[model samples]
Structure formats: C-alpha cells, structure tokens
Target: MADVKSKASVLLVGGGSVGAIAALNLETGKQAAVTIVCRSNFNAVSQNGYNIKSCDHGKINNWKPTKVLNAIPKASEGSTFDYIVCVTKNVPDVPPSLSDLIRPAVVPGKTVIVLIQNGLNIEKPLIAAYPQNIVLSGVSLIGANEPSPGHIDQDFPDTLFIGAFANPNLSPQTQKAAAEDFVSRYSAGGKTQCSLDTRVDWTRWRKLVYNSCLNSICAITDLDTGRIRLADDAVAHLVRPAMLEIVAAAKAAGHELPATVVDDMIEMDPLDMYLPPSMLSDTRKGNFIEYENILGEPLREGEKLGVPMPTLRVLYYLCQAIQWKNKELRGLVSIPPKGNYVT
Candidate 1:
C-alpha cells in the first residue's frame, strides 16, 4: 500500500541546470523532501550548494537540497519517493541507464519516473522497465546553463510543459494523479506548467521541430542560432529543410507537428539569435553530446515508419561524427556529463 502523505518525497538524480531549476521549484513551500544526487560534483555541491539565477524563480543565491549524494546512496535502500526525476541526459549507450539510476529510490510499482531530459520516444525504456510505474515527462523551454560548479543560469521562458506519457497501457486517472501531485508541488510561484493538447506526447515532437534545426545547425557550424541562419543562406538551404523533414516524419508517425513551427522558430527574437543550444554548447566544449537519444532515435523511428528523412539522416551522420571525435579525444565510453546539459 502507498503512504498517503500530504507532503511528497522527490529524488532528483542530476544536479545540472534543469536539475537545479527543478529542485528550486519543487521544494517551494518545502512541499516535498528533495534529495539531489550530484555524482562527481558532490564535493562542490555539498559545500557550495546551488547558485541559481533565473528569469522566473528569481535569484536563489544558495539553494541546497535536503540531502546530496556522490552516487545513488544507500539511504534509499528502504525508502521510496513520490517522484524520481532524471534530469540527466538519456544516452542509451551509457551503462546503468536511467532505469538503473532510479532503482535505489524506487518503490517498485508505485514511484513515478519523471524524465526531464530531451529526446523523443524516450519514455519507452522506463515504461518497459517499470511497467506499473507512472512515467511523466517535461519539455523545459527555459534556457538554463551551468557556468561553473554549483551554479546555474536559467534564462528565458518561465514555463515547462509536463504530463503523463502517451501510453495506452497506462490509466489516465493514475497519470493525472501523478501530474497533479507534481503540479501541487511545482505551482508555488508564477512558474507556468502547462498540460497542452490533453496529451503530452505531442509536446516532445513539437520541441524536436526547433531542436533538430537549431541544435544541429549550431553544433556543426559552431555558431549561435541566429548566426547560423544568417550565414551563407543556411536558414533556407539547411535549417528550414531539416525542420521540414522532421515535420513530415512526425506526421507519418501519426503525430501532428504544425507546419508553422519553422517560421515561428526562424522569427524568434533576442531571444532567438543568441544563446547556443545545450547540444551545441556540449559539442563546442568537447563534452559528450546526446547524439543517440536526441537525434539517432528520432531518425531511426522515421526510417522504421517509412518516412524519408534525407535531411535528418545527414544531420544525424554529421552529429555522430562530432560525437565520435569528442569521445576519442576524451577517452570515454559511456557516461553522461555531470550536468546533463551543462557545457
């Protein structure tokens, strides 16, 4: 049986930008007991704590978790949390996948696996691992970066879209319960948490529309979003075409991604031109990029569905080359960066 406590227990597994921002927001009203797994940066985080500068959740100079661990701690041996958020990057090639990271804190069939990372069709592995566990996801539009240890910069849209995974085997009531529980803990401030389209699956596909363009374009060319499009007619010849391929692929896979997304992304101001994307930043900094989960999986899906994504295929191959170079340069096999999107 589940303990019906008013206060929830949340175990955040990554101390990256999204992880810090999530910790700051979810712990409002101290509604939930938040424990952060800092991994390698545990020493820095334990002493300094999180230094957050946000456009939404205004400057929290020192936001410390109830507990921090260098790895999945034994403290979770007999304990289970209401929410287990994996803000860590979803690199399937990596060992101890997300499924393994949440093991210690999980209560078997009861805990909710909240994946706050980027990627499409990412919830499948968790859904397969914990068939009964309610899996929820969030697409964070906010721009967040880790400039240094225990420090995070959260700039941009003060909103995040979250809801239950699109799965027929799951019960809507159960999913909503999990969503509402998170909302209850997350709605302390003016932060916007939207549940659009009555289904959360579309949100992931929608973000891909922009990410596929900007993330790849910026990473390959080593330029910001605006600069990439502004150079050598890149927007017309490269970015726009790749985005169109994604739109077509999504449609063929039975997901409707609006065609207007291309124009909307192109026209984004400030706002749009500056700040390189997470993937782009990671590549430039020689950090491990989420090539497989973010780009590879989506392209494979398009191929499986018979959707011809020649542009996306090319983009994937390019990103993969960079990924290989980074790995070879660093002598690494499988491990996400300490901060998921930290560059």
Candidate 2:
C-alpha cells in the first residue's frame, strides 16, 4: 500500500464541469490537497460550493475542495505545488497563453504539469516551455457541462487516460513514474476511472476520429449530436468522410487506427441523445470555440504529411469563419474596411 500519510498538494486550474469533477475526486480520497482556480464562478463556488448531478457518483451536493480561488496565486506566496493540472481549453490563438497562466505555480524540477485537453500535438508547447519538468497528457471521455454557474450536469461518467509526454530533458522512466503516480492519486476517489496509458498518442489519434468529425460538424451546423445524426445522409456524406480523412492523416503521422473506428464513433451516441459537444456549447454561448486547436492543427499536420484531407479542409474553413465571427462579436478582433483588400 502507498503511504497515505504523505499528501501531495495539487493546484487544478479551470473549475468548469470537467475541472469540478476532477477536483472533487482528487480531494475525495484525501491523497492530495486540492486548490481549484475558478475564474468565472469563483464567488458562486466559494459561497455555495459546486452542485454536481453525476450519473456515476449520484447527486453530490455542495462539494468543495480544499481551496477555491478566482486566480492563481503569485510565486511570492511561497507555496510550490506538487502537481498543476490544467483542464482548460487549449486555444493557442486566443489571448492568455497556457504557459503564462500556469507559470506562477511551476517549481522548476519538482512541480509536474498535467494537461487534460483536446486536439493533436497539444503537449508540444508545454514540453518546450518546461523542459526540465515532467509533463503529463490526459485524454478523457465524459459528458458534462455547467448549465449555470456552480452547477454541473454529468450524464456520462469520468474515464481519463493519462501518460507522460515525450521529453528529452527528463528520462522516460522518470516521466512514466510521475504519470503513474498521478493516475493512482486521481483514481483514489474510486468513482472515476483513471488509468496509465503507454500509447497515449495513439489513444489521442483514435479520439481525433470522433472529435475532428462530429465536434466540428455539430458546432458548424448548430445542431446537437442527435439531430446531426438524424439529418439526411449527414453521417455518410459529411461525418464519415471527414473521420476517414483524419484517420488517414493519423496513419501518415505513424498512428494506425482501426478501419471500423469511424463507424464505431458514429454509433456511439443514440439518435435522441441531443447532447451538445463542448465546441457547440461554446458556439451557443458566443464564446470562442477551439477551432485552431481542434481543426487547424490537424489540418496543418495533414498537409505536412502529404495526406489528402479535402473534407477536413472544408470544415476547417467553415470553423475559421465561425471563430472569426465569435471574435468580432466579443471585440477581440477587428476587421478592416471592405475595400482595404482591393486586388
């Protein structure tokens, strides 16, 4: 048995639906003291705690971690965290880069950085920024969202797979041990399923087949997953082809997924599910969707690998327009006069 007396200090950034559930579990086992950064709902969470309606854990009322704050504390606070887990969206094109957001808590070689996010090659930037630190990558499949502040609705249970990102500065053995330790601590709650994955990149590629297709398509059409599936030939004409393109690109990049993966992803949801993906929810809320992370990165990879991704290219162009509109609405970007681009 592991030493239960030795408790690790964990700082979890992003207290949205996914982050809340992760924080809940991280503290449930008493293995780690968790401090969550809730940027949007700090007051609500601090006052009343999170109200989670989970299928796995049942109705969890007024669940609070060890600490909750609106922002990360500065380094001058004199507290170095053992693990900094970031469940925030990876929108590199957006302002407030991930590195800058988590820089305050990083303790050189001691603090491990863990990212549970979507998209391909999301670990590269962190690995570059923290060369001497161990970086862990997590991929999760859970249906969860915050319909209102401090309230989480989770229809699917949390099942997270974590692995160490490849880093030249740290030995593979060291990175793997750190990842395994996190998996153990994260699963201590016994409600969630957390496991260590050796082939994490391949796992990500497998997920991309679904994320690159349905996630983008649902957001573009403004339709829920069920309605998209019920549309006329939407699965055959749009979804499957796009998934095939992603699978081909993954193969070119040295990850060979199964041929039936497309079909499997398509059938995963029921026709009446009516669940909106994270990207679609962002679109509905007028927030900037992760177009660059989810689509642009994969499209660029496909181009570099010489893989033909025509369907994905179309989706990428459409998502770019949507993201641009979102930025314009929020005044985060400006458009020049119509005549400014005269040929």
Candidate 3:
C-alpha cells in the first residue's frame, strides 16, 4: 500500500442505498474527496445532491459529491483514484465490468478496488480484469434502502467486514495494511463500523448463510427474512434445509462454514420484518436479480466437487425465472393481453 496518505481520492460507483451510506461514511470528517457515479438519479443528485436519513448518522439532506456522472468521464481517462469503492449489485456479465468502468482511475500499485457486494466469487472478474491492482471484498450486515430518488434510509449498526482478495503475489502484510487503512478511513465513531477480517473466503461463504436463504427465500415467498423464519413451518421445511445444503457446498469447496451461520441468520431480529432484501427489491421493481454469482456459481462448484445442491439448484432456477421475467420487462418487451397474444 502506498504511504498511508491523509487524503485519498475515492471514486464510488452505484449510488444506491449502500452506495449512499458508503459515501456518507467517506464524507463525514474523512479526508477523502468522494465522487459518485449514479446510474438512475444522475440528474437529481447532480442538481440537488444526495439526501440521506440514517439511524446512525441522522438526517443529512442535500449532501453533494465532488462530482456525479452517469459514467466515468472522458477527462478522467488517465487520472487515478486512490480507492474505488463499488457498492453495486453483483450481476456479472450483465452491465459493464469493473475494469471497463474504472480503467482510468486505477493506478496499479496505488489504487485499491473495494467490492461491497454479495455472494461467492464476486471478485473473480475484477481480479482477472485488473491483475495488477489490489482488490478487496467486503460484506456489509445492515438493512438499507432507497425509498425515493436521492433519499436513503439506513439501519443502525452497519458492520462491514473487509478483507483483501487472496492474491499469491501480494504478501499478507501488504494486504493487511491496505485493508486496515480502509477500515480506518471508513469506520466512523460508531456509525457504520468497518473491520479488517483476514478471512475473505470465510466471510464470503459464511455470509452466504444468510444471503442464499434470506435473500432468495424472501423474494421467493414474498416475505421478509424475519417473517420467513418466523412462519410456522418455513424454517424447518425450507430455510434451514437450503442453508444446510449451502454449508455442505462451502465445506466441499474447502471452507468449513459453521451451522451457527444459519442459526445467526434465523435469529436476526424480527423487528425489521418488512425490510426487503435487494433480490426481492429488484424482483418487485422488475429489475434483474443476481442469480449466477449468488446461487449458480456455488451450485456449479458443489457439483464439480461432487456435492449436490438440489435445494439451491431449485431456488436458483426460481430466481432465474424471476430474472428472465424482469429482463423482459426491463428490456421494454411488451406482452399483449391473453386474447390478443400471438401464439
């Protein structure tokens, strides 16, 4: 890591609720100049800035970024960012790749790319795309949502576990410094705390304990995580079984995730009963959900390792069906009424 600078030039992509929280974290007394690239609310955010309300940080209205754009600028064609934190959905092979979007901002040894996304093997493409740049993976445990344009509601105690993506070439000490430095910059007194977790693979697989079950299950059953777990027979018949299958797959993949992972997920406070997971939110909005990375990849890996994930396979197929329907709607494909439909 470059001599731990006081001020880091950060480029944050994906201006969703997670992105907004991250931007707020970087901006509140941190010495980083945060620039956001918003895909949907570019005009609103550009004209009026971002407005956020958080249980941790309180109300911060019209908090503007250094710059906002729909895409990376042409002028930044050769510029460099000290850090590029992406708080976007992990839908690889869907939109642009990370390197493609942030090509100009990364300065090999100087830049660190932080991916705060869900699921296993999310960093593979970014690592493959920019083999020289440092890549970090993070999993955030919190409920946040963008209810309206430029308005975000953040739940309390956002704990982000960050770790360096395993690179044989990079020494452990170097990875530690980079990861800890980010923790230092992002961890406010108590708002959205960040920690350096050395176990990247463990974090990813363990988080799947909640994600593989809560995210898809919630979306599938039209219930929140709590509701799904609290229902009379939901946990026994569906949630626990699916999570056990995931744990088996993780073990087969050489990461021994404890069954307590499932327990912890099941025990998550039922107070936030209506908070929808991103997958469910996307489904509700008729937007594409991340099926491959979150579900398919692990299933494929399990199959390769001779472990069958029939439950995950079925749920994955369900999510894929949702994805297909969403893709068609998002692509502006119109379906006529049953009487007028062309056979």
- Clash count list over all predictions: 1, 0, 0
Model 1, runs deviating above 4 Å: 1-5, 167-169, 194-197, 269-273, 332-343
Which residue pairs of candidate 3 clash?
none
- Candidates arranged by lDDT, highest first: 2, 3, 1
What lDDT is obtained when candidate 2 is compared to the true structure?
0.88
For model 3, how does the per-residue alpha-carbon lDDT over 66-131 read when each residue is reduced to its tens digit?
767788644346656778998877777466666677766667666799998887777777777777
**How well does candidate 3 score on lDDT at residue 56?**
78
Worst 10 residues of 3 by lDDT: 72-81
lDDT of each: 0.77, 0.88, 0.78
| Top candidate (lDDT) | 2
Order the candidates by TM-score, highest first: 2, 3, 1
Give the TM-score of each candidate: 0.89, 0.96, 0.90
lDDT of 2 by residue, 116-145 (tens): 998887878887877799999899988899
